[model samples]
Target: MFCERSSGDVQKEDKSSSVAVILCFFGEQQQGGVSDEAEPFMGSGRFGKSPTSPLHHVKVVSSPFHVALKVNFLCQLFIRLWPDGRNLQLHFRSRLSLPLFTGGKVEGEQGAAIHIVLLDVNTGHVVTSGPESTIKLDVVVLEGDFNNEDDEGWTEEEFESHVVKEREGKRPLLTGDLQVTLKEGVGTLGELTFTDNSSWIRSRKFRLGLKVASGFCEGIRVGEAKTEAFTIKDHRGELYKKHYPPALNDDVWRLEKIGKDGSFHKRLNKSGIFTVEDFVRLVVRDSQKLRTILSSGMSNKMWDALIEHAKTCAMSGKLYVYYADDTRNVGVVFNSIYELSGLITGEQYLLSDSLSDSQKVQKWLIYTKNWFDFDH
Candidate 1:
């Protein structure tokens, strides 16, 4: 058997071989917001490698800290476990690319907004009910490298308990304080704006540090959470030129095409469907996945309507009254909208200045009357 010492050193646990042993899974308070590699966990005490030994849950110390594995798998009788920190996990994530549009955004020029949220950390399960939770948000913006060893940079936490420690000597990235109420009892809204006196920062890398207050879960006082640092840059027209906007609005949940039932959307998130583009891809690529998008169930009529809705959104912003033509589905698109506008309205009526307005109307009426009589 083997165990992890509090000093973070791992060695053989020869003394505790006869008895089951538990190791404290303590994660270091990371400063840079980068993805830190957690130490390896070896099973012991009726766990780890011996199915005949015994079976029980392995409780970890940190409660709610996140650990990302490069290539991991769980097998039949082998298991490692931890308390879910009373289900409090901040949703702050490591963002690689941030783009901007008119609706609002996280990265780009000034006047963009930063949205905050707290999720009952999903460990491959759908948490349908949200607690009467309230999260206090405070963001600190830094001009340079936030991960410097000497500085106590941003720490990502969802609970209120650890937020005080993170903000002890830190400065915020935004100009002023911020807060808001979440309808689902887990999210809020805030804009990213600096005070007028703050100098222009058109060409600098800024790290978004966040802290959230802890809330109650099943009568136990759960601790707060610090999220991973999200790096936002002021790209100054560089990001806009290369990037393309998504088919749907940035806030995919608020879309009308998807029903407003909150539980339905929650299931979508659990299935790795966040954006409409992600949802559309699933519906178009696989029929079974589309029918099963709702955990409860959806009728074929509703499913077909949504699939058509998604395809309409994908091809063009406007919805068209036509079925998908699989035979001629592939195509080369042109700027035919403007080119056909003259034909649609009649090119002669548009340019003939000698014809009076009434005469033009009469000509169109006479031609339409004759055309409709024969066509009908």
Candidate 2:
């Protein structure tokens, strides 16, 4: 027999002819009394004998040896007398961005996803519908690094004991989907992946912690959610990672002095300049003949760090416009790799004079400098 209701619900009553009550889990903490007048302890075979039914005085404080641990401790003490008794947390509704490589997968920093909520710290609600909204949490891998300006006045047991420190020796290994259930109180965290590489730590940074995972009876009293310190590296530094905007068929050694085969990637693949849209169509048609083909083994600061890392590639607005025939004199505006965008000039066009012996402006400036070895 058991029943607790401040609207936290937990009921189980059957009183078959008396003597069923049994509260000795340390005699309700040395008789702090929750109402009882003695007489209850009859057990003898099938722990039975129900004849006149009478049991109804159970205020047992702790040893719930079953019935799912007394319905998980009266649903975590009625979620600390819920509704307004404060206390409840697990925040990180997203925050863990940056180049986190190692074995890869953890995203955000423009990739989004990585949630985990639950909150309620005195009505800032989000405990969505009670019993801590079907808890499950977990996601570990934390070690030190936190200071939102010293987390202003802390205290949810100091941010749930500030991620109980973990990483020291062989730690990293946090494979994919490290548990996640909660639905209305949020959860997300899917493809986690870490597998080592905190770059020989000494605060090379790393953090993620969550909690509440153990036979799910998470009866509230939440509080535990880290994730802000990040750095994973070494998946061969994601092939020299640094592609904020870069991506037009990537791989021109992912920019920055193009090192895949080094020496400015063998002089941009022996000058045919493979991908990154063929080095942004030869740096928009002849950046001084692509800096005279890597200025003799490159240097003007490595050709301005490979033309500021191929000007952070992200072009492809798909425009074309070209005109020279009907005398619109010049109109040029290329893109989608024809590069040059916008140059119309006709009021007695001069464009620095010599229209190179115009055969229709030298066949539209040799079809925008052989728009990538032009075949069609």
Backbone collision count in every prediction? 18, 7
lDDT of 1 by residue, 122-224 (tens): 3532233544345354454443333444433333322222222123343443443455444454553454443221123332333445543334233322223
Candidate 1 regions with alpha-carbon error over 4 angstroms: 1-87, 92-114, 123-132, 142-173, 181-183, 195-203, 214-340, 344-376
Best of the candidates, TM-score: 2
Candidate 2 segments whose C-alpha is farther than 4 A from its true place: 1-91, 101-108, 111-117, 120-207, 210-220, 223-231, 234-239, 247-251, 255-259, 262-264, 267-269, 272-278, 282-312, 316-322, 329-332, 339-376
- The TM-score between candidate 2 and the true structure equals 0.37
Model 2 per-residue lDDT at 143 = 55
Instruction: Compose the digit string of candidate 2's lDDT tens values, residues 1-376.
Output: 3422222122233322212332322123343432343324434432232542232233333444554565665445444445357567788877666878877789756788877788777778787766577788888775556444565334445555545333567554787788898987887888987877765556777788777887764444566777678778779878777686788888788877677877877887888878888877777767898888777767798777767777777876776656655656756556677754445566543332333445445546746654555441
